[model samples]
Target: YTFGVGLITYLCSKEIYVMEHEYYSGLSIGIMAIVAVKKLGPVIAKWADGEIDKIEGEWKQGREAELKVLADAIEAEKKEQWRA
Candidate 1:
């Protein structure tokens, strides 16, 4: 978008820049860049949090599954000894 604006500004330079001395164009571009950053801040933060949750959830699930398997094996071994 900034590149698009720059290209447009260059193309319209003879008319816009000639009248305003490029200050207006520069200010518009600066304002647009700041607005874009403000808008994307929350979305970026949410994306990071979602990624962290996915990674941590997988790790927790893997640990629980491992513990369950270990407990089941121990129970089975005890049953076999009791039968003996």
Candidate 2:
């Protein structure tokens, strides 16, 4: 959204001012980038945290399955020892 507006602004500025004096252009871009980060940073952080949670859940499920398998094996070993 901001990028689109910035692009249009840059194109228009280029056409009107020939972009020879690039300070304004650079400033506008810098400002836009700062605004973009300020606006999107928390959203991005939340998304990253959601992704981390998903991976952690998957890891926990895998560990639980492994634990179940190990427990079953241990139970069988104990039963065999009791029979012996």
Candidate 3:
């Protein structure tokens, strides 16, 4: 940036160059970027949270199925032992 400014100053025979227009333009762009992130942050987080909740629910179902299978196996073993 300094090099660009120096080259422009040298070419124009001026110590200061035009920055007012670009500065405000850049500031506005930065502000817009901040606003966009702020507005989207919660919505994106909610979507991610919902996806996480869905995955958790799926894991819970799988865990319940595994527990049921274990319980059934135990019940069958107990019955067989009683018969013996």
TM-score of 2: 0.66
Candidate 3 accuracy as lDDT: 0.91
Per-candidate Cα lDDT values, in order, are 0.91, 0.93, 0.91
* Model 2 lDDT tens row, 37-76: 9999999999999999999999999999999999999999
Q: Note each model's CA RMSD in angstroms.
A: 8.5, 10.1, 6.1
Model 2 lowest lDDT segment of ten: 12-21
Identify the superior model by lDDT, candidate 2 or candidate 3: 2
Off by over 4 Å in 2: 1-22
**Winning model by TM-score:** 2
lDDT score for residue 20 of model 2: 56
Candidate 1, residue 11: the lDDT equals 71
* Residue 75, candidate 1: alpha-carbon lDDT: 100
Q: Show model 3 residue runs off by greater than 4 Å.
A: 1-30
lDDT of 3 by residue, 1-84 (tens): 999987987856753555567888999999999998999989999999999999999999999999999999999999999999
Task: Note the residue pairs that clash in candidate 1.
Answer: none
